[model samples]
Target: MQTRRRFKQTKTLSDRLADEAARCRAEARTLTPGRRREMLLRQARQDETAMQIEAWLRSPGLRAPT
Candidate 1:
């Protein structure tokens, strides 16, 4: 039987996502206005959205489904 690989993550999910978004935005800034830059910007937006969702999901205000 093969055991699943385990790893420790030093950063929180939101932090990682935020970092990735920032990186994407920075890289996008270097590129001329085009598909690749647009794609990078889109990816950064996705990361930001995911981070927001993750934060919402983890909020203490979240209640269990009835």
Candidate 2:
């Protein structure tokens, strides 16, 4: 059994995101634990970010005419 490699991000978010996405696609071949976790975390982060943005949009100070 091989150990799953951990990736380090030293570049911009976009760059790191693309690299991570590529890794996830490649890892589907092996079904590695690390890749699964990474994909789930990435999805969670996206969901959280969207929620925050929606909340901000609904705030009185930022809300627009409906």
Give the candidate number with the greatest lDDT. Answer: 1
The alpha-carbon lDDT assigned to residue 32 of candidate 1 equals 100
* lDDT tens per residue, model 2, 4-66: 999976785555555655564565546656767677667656655665666677678984669
The runs of at least 3 residues in candidate 1 whose Cα sits more than 4 Å from the true structure, single-residue gaps closed, are none
Clash pairs, candidate 2, are none
What lDDT does model 2 reach? 0.63
lDDT of the candidates, in the order given: 0.98, 0.63
Over 1-66, each residue of candidate 1 has an lDDT whose tens digit, in order, gives 999999999999999999999999999999999999999999999999999999999999999999
